[model samples]
Target chain A: MRYTSFTSYDLILLAQGLGVSVALFLVTTLIGFLIGTIWAVMRFYRVPLLTPLITFLAELLKNSPVLVQLFLVFFGLPALLKINVTPVEAAVITLSGNTAAFIYVIAVAAIESIGRDQIESARVFGLSRWQILRHVVAPQAMAFAIGPLTGLLVNQLQVTSLISVIGVVDLTKIGNILNLRTLKPFIVWTVVGGLYYIAAKLIALGGARLERRLRAHTAWKGL
Target chain B: MILAPHVPFLLKGALLTAEACALALFGSLVIGLLVAALRTSSSPLLSRAAFIYVDLFRNIPFIVQLFFFFYGLPEIGIYIDAFTTGVLALSIAGGAFSSDVIRSGILAIDTGILEAAEVSGLSKPTIFRKIVMPIALRTSIRPLGSVFINLVLTSSILSTITLNELTGSAKIVASDTFRPFEVYAVLLIVYASLTYLISLAIGALHRRLNRDRMPDVA
Candidate 1:
């Protein structure tokens, strides 16, 4: 007896798969956010030798393929360093670093968008560097950064799909399993791609909302 | 220690990676130029068709598209090797992106300049050839560099279809060498450094190309 029909359980599998992808995405994004902010600050302060080094590191991470980064972490690092790296761990590290690199660039640009006069004024007002960053730079920079940040997040969402290759059992991997079992690329891939598409759209929508809120202070109040 | 012996094999893989990226870059540029022209054309139908192609390719995951072509192609009469398939897929995807850059480049051309050429009695083909393309290309050289960098990064996905480019080669070395972490770390650094150098060169080129056109900010 051949069982070629689509099973009802595949829905559950897809949901579970998407859960893994989203969970990993959120976790890494948070980690990446923090690390990327730090990298940006490194540049902002002109930390002597460290600034160029961070810039170089970010460039390297930004330019190279995530797949190579994944392999390096997942397959290469374990063998060379003689340490165990879970697939999820590898995915998190690689994706976070990659995300951070892009964010670092955006943050630096956002910070720079705040003209020197504004920074100098803040400096004159007896604001500490930390206070200036928090009270002066961060607010304005966030507004400046949000537009490009939305684009980056959208691209990063697509990038999360690559983690499936490292055996993270993410949505893409689930689709692979279902596709082979059901032998229906049309049904399987369409469903998988639809889920991804919806998720991407949702992120974009959320980003738009966040950007609006961030930019609210800068909205014109009319003369 | 284990991977020390695989240097020769890895070098061979690097060569394959270079070859694939080189071919794919040329293929993408040709495809990009044609699509860019279509996008900017006066014909609404052609422009709409080009827009749909770009949107479809950009929205779909590369792996899904790759699998569709890899599995779906055999169902049809077409049969191509993995290397060829990889290059073809890269070209299509890269073209979609490259076209966007080129289209903007085309749009950025001065209407005044075009008018001058037209008033000179230059044909459409000659105007596009001698006047528009050179200027658009010179201004866009930097954006095009990023697209190519993304293409290089995307090439790693080609490995899943059984094409052992640089990342593919490193995969074998990792398992055989019994140092997955170290091997991958090194590979990551190598790729990063390679692209850094490429962008540095692009920056230099952009500065040179736009040196005389300072006010325009090419």
Candidate 2:
């Protein structure tokens, strides 16, 4: 007899799926943030050959679909490099790289948003370039970048769902499994979508809170 | 190298992708305009309903929405083909995003224009048609272009539903020749170039439409 009835275990399965999704999202987001910030720094320093190359790579990543990028890493990389790539590994790599590309753009823009006069004043204070960046740019850029970064985070959270395609057992993959087993697409997918929606909203809320904190200094305080 | 044999097959897939995108683009624009209208309407209830629709659609991952339609619709006795399901899903999701763009466009309109139209005794529909839509759409052409380009990219996800769009056909060719790398890499470049060309065209269109406005941006 086909065991198609709804099991309480399914909730546990969903939680597990959500856990995997969030974990991967966090890990990849951290890696992407570091790599993206580094790329922005490279551009800031005007590293001749690497700067344009990084820009080009970011452009390609930004323009293409994440699904295509996933396929390239999951299927393409193993075949080309003769390496074993687990589904989770592929998801991490692809999502991180994709996230990095976007973060790089925001970082570059944030850095550029800083006026030249501020940097010149810091320079005249005899601060080195690195010191100037650390003292004069980092805080202001963080404030400027936080807003866009939140938007990107919300998007990247949704993007984490795509990892299901590469068999990462993310929320969508769990939804797929439940969908086929119970043949209840409406219930299964709705629950799955609801989970994602909540997660996205939470991220947005967190981002908004962070943005508020970052911008608190500039906020009006007049009586 | 082996891709030479599959070029014709991939082109066939590309054509299907184009067809689905075109249909979905039109569907999305219509839905987007309607939603934008509702969201901007004076009635708080209609505007709130539209807001909820946009928010719900925007927050959810699209794959979930696709599965919801693909499997849920059949259960409800709506037996549409995978292609129709894909297009419908794309339009619904794309509508949410496009509506946001159009709503922003509408909000950016000068209050003076609306007041002037009112003083000229223009009907609501007429005002929207002659004054609101033209100005809003003109200013928003660039953002709408990005939204449409996103539509094109998102259309690739339709492959998961057994619709043999570009990505779907490429998956077939990849397995057939055991050349996943070349197939997907080429697919990546094709998608990038496709969106790049789209943005370029959108840039030109934006300039053309907004020519009389800000010369700085144009």
lDDT of 2 at B72: 97
Every model's DockQ:
0.53, 0.91
Per-residue lDDT value at B41 in model 2: 98
Query: Which runs of model 2 end up more than 4 angstroms from their true locations?
Result: none
The digit string of per-residue lDDT tens for model 2 on B47-91 reads: 999999999999999888999999999898889999999999999
What is the DockQ (computed on Cα atoms) for candidate 2?
0.91
DockQ, computed on Cα atoms, for candidate 1 = 0.53
Q: For each candidate, C-alpha RMSD in Å?
A: 2.6, 1.0
After the best TM-score superposition of candidate 1, give how far the Cα of residue A208 lies from its true spot, in angstroms. 2.9
Task: Give me the candidate number with maximum lDDT.
Answer: 2
lDDT of 1 by residue, A9-65 (tens): 778999999999889888888999999999898787778998888888888888778
* TM-score between model 1 and native: 0.91
Writing each residue's lDDT as its tens digit, candidate 2 over A1-223 gives 4689889999999999999999999999999999999999999999999999999999999999999999999999999999999999999999999999999999999999999999999999999999999988999999999999988998999999999998899888999999989998889998998999999999999989999998999999897
lDDT tens digits, residue span B38-153, model 1: 99989999999999888777766788677767765665668899998888889999999999999999999989998999999999889877987888888899999999888888
Error of 1 at B188 (Å): 2.0
